[model samples]
Target chain A: MTELVKVKNLHKSFGTLDVLKGINLTVEAGETVVLLGSSGSGKSTLLRCINFMETPTEGRVYLNGEAVGDDVNGKMRYKEADLCKLRSRIGMVFQHFNLFPHMSVLQNVMEGQITVLGRRQEEAKDKSMAQLQRVGLAEKASEYPSRLSGGQKQRVAIARALAMDPEVMLFDEVTSALDPELVGEVLKTMRQLAEEGMTMICVTHELGFAYHVANRVLFLNQGEIHEEGQPQALLKTPKTQRMREFLDGHALFKLPE
Target chain B: MEWNFAPVLGSMDILLLGLLNTLKVTGLALLFGVPLGLGLALSRLSQMRILSMVAAFIIEFFRTTPPLVQLFWFFFAFPILFGVNMTPFTTAIVTFSIQSSAFFAEIFRSGIQSIDKGQWEGSKAIGMTRNQTLRRVILPQAVKRMIPAFMERSIELLKTTTLVSTIAYTDLMYQANDIAQRTFRPLEVYTVIAVIYFLLIFVFSQLSIVVERRLAKSGEGTVH
Candidate 1:
């Protein structure tokens, strides 16, 4: 497998507090990698830095071997316009699907294509309808985002990103904001996308979904990788004490410990 | 006293001419005010510190001062200050536009700010430029929220066209004043003028309600 993304010594800080410290990672093309960490472990921050949503203070992130964060005077900086283009190449999906409220589902999806990519309306509308149908929401294309269910909104958001035809898709705790029942539908959509060989980096606490979908799981602890292995090896077998403790802690997520 | 409705009927031809003049002023004001108001709203919401601050000062000044005073200054005082010869009707339209824009700008800004932050973030993520996002995504939503307020202002502007008579412009109020002066029927003439104004404003308000319902039903479109 060829490397689709590469990061080296990634570090980011807000004021004096270090959020991401020395994170190094590489993902092969068409690979699905799940980042497993408790909240505030810098998993989401790492994803943001990948897309230049949160600029890394010191490090280099490469998309298709092109460095996104520039190395200058021992600090990495990104120009805003460059970041916009880089972000287009890297689509970041949010926990709460950020669909435009003032637009129809069709317009919301088509807007980027027409306005950014400068496609003609007919061409963009055709592609947008195709994507909406792919996500099982073609009938709802003329419907507003306010009327969609959380799952449907998320699917629309997913379709909106897909319309950009980005090289890498980032999911930041996508199901964390969904209802317990609704989570499965969105997960199913992601699972289908994964089956269709879309390169994805997902930061999620859903180990079951990760086990079912991710090609590999990267376990992070204290803002560093504690363990990394295949899903079967990571989930079903004995490994590091850190991994054991992490999985055992899932019992607290249960009613009876 | 018995009602003398015959005079009003006899003078309907003059009233129609005044009505036509009212439509012209109203049309010109809306055409000028909405776009000018949009620009003001954008500048006021601008990231630039000094420009937005100055815009805030202007909005506050116009909002606090009477539009009639502003019109007076534009007609009488500003000519000496600027040393330019502008027409009375032109001056009336310009002054009314400037006065109406402050309120319109504030309304637009509120409407824009009312939209979800998600729409903005979503727009950016989709690779749209800042200008494209504002034009396509932001303004459409803002304009929708602004329609009712826009209609209310249109009616206000419809009434404020009367102020044009002060500048010696040939609008509805000017015709009414002229007719009242010549006919020596202040009570009858002014009463007829009031009813004409009422009819225009009433028809306009009803039309606005219909547009509002259509927009609300269609889910999202242009401002009513």
Candidate 2:
């Protein structure tokens, strides 16, 4: 598989606090990589850096082998227009689902398609409806997000990203905000996407999902990846004491057989 | 003292004309002010330091100063300072439009800022340019929450328009003053004009309440 996303020694700092330091990763097309870490381990920041949502203080990100920002005097500088274009091809769903409140689900899904992709309205609507149907939310097309349950809003958010026809999808703890019962429906939709061969990078605490869906899992510690391997081996037999201690904390849920 | 309203009744046409003038100024000021306020709000929220500072200065200057003083400055001082002719009507429109816009800009800024940062991140994640996201997502949501505040500012602008009478503008207050002196019925004329102002303002307040309720029913201004 071709490397679709590559992070080269990426570093991000908010003032003096380093969120991500000396991180390197490579995600090939159709690979589902789950990021697992304790809070403040830089999992979400690493995902954000992929889309330039959080500009890296240093280093580079490559999509399909094309560097995202311009290399200027040994430092990366991004033009707004260039970053916008780059972001359009990389889909991301946030924890809050951030659907536009003024728009219906169908309109929310169609917005990026029409505005960013410059598709005709009719064509965009058709594409958006298909995505909604894919997420089993076709009936909710006309409903406002405020009227939907948490799971339904998340599904609509997923459809919104999918309608963009992105090369890769990044999910930043998309299920974290949902009520316990509502998480299954969102996970089911994500699993379906993985089975359909969409390249994905996910930052999640759902180890069951990692075991079931992720081809590989990366365990982060203090702004760096401390361990990486296939889910079955890495999760069950973590090589380091830090990974074991983290897993012990989440021992409540049984990993899927 | 015996009540006498016959003189006030005789000058109904003039009072009506003055009311019309008041409305004309209020309407024109809103038409100019709302858009100007939006411009100023956007500039103040802009990333450029110089642009935001300039916008903040304009908003602060007009908001801190008294509206009456602003009207007097435009009507009496502007023509001399600029060496141009200034009509009372023009002066009222210019002063009130900018003055009301300063207040409107604050309302708009707060409305826009009140939107969740997740909304911006969501829009950005979809690859929308900042302008596209603002025009499509942020402003639409922000404008809904701003309805009540906008109406309040508009009512304040309407009442402030009375200051134009001091410059010899033929507004309701000025006409009331004229009718009062001519007929020696200050009590009756002033009372009638006060009631007229109250009724007009009451209608606006009720209209805004209705709009706010309708917006609530439609599930707007509730999303974070």
Tens digits of lDDT, candidate 1, A179-217: 889998889989999999999999988888777889999
Q: Give per-model CA RMSD.
A: 3.8, 1.5
Separately for all candidates shown, the number of backbone clashes (residues 3 or more apart, or on different chains) is 0, 0
lDDT per residue as tens, model 2, B55-134: 99999999999989898899889999999898999999999899988888899899999899999999999999999989
User: Where is model 1 more than 4 Å wrong at Cα?
Assistant: A11-18, A69-77, A101-108, A120-148, A219-257, B1-12, B213-224
Give the per-residue lDDT of model 2 (tens digit) for A1-257: 89999999999999999999999999999999999999999999999999999999999999999988888888778999999998999999999999998899999999999889999999999999999999999999999999999999999999999999999999999999999999999999999999999999999999999998999999999999999999999998999999999999997967656
In candidate 2 chain B, what residue range of length 10 has the lowest lDDT sum? B215-224
DockQ for every model, please: 0.46, 0.88
TM-score quality measure for candidate 1 = 0.85
Measured on C-alpha atoms, candidate 2 has an lDDT of 0.94
Q: How much is the lDDT of residue B34 in candidate 2?
A: 95
Highest TM-score model number: 2
Give a tens-digit lDDT track for model 1, residues B1-224.
65565666677787678778777877887888888888888899989999899888888898999888988899888889999876887788788788888888888888888777866777777666667778988887777777877888888888888888888787888888888777667788889889878887899899988988887787754332
Cα miss at B117, model 1 (Å)?
A: 1.1
Interface RMSD of each: 1.6, 0.6
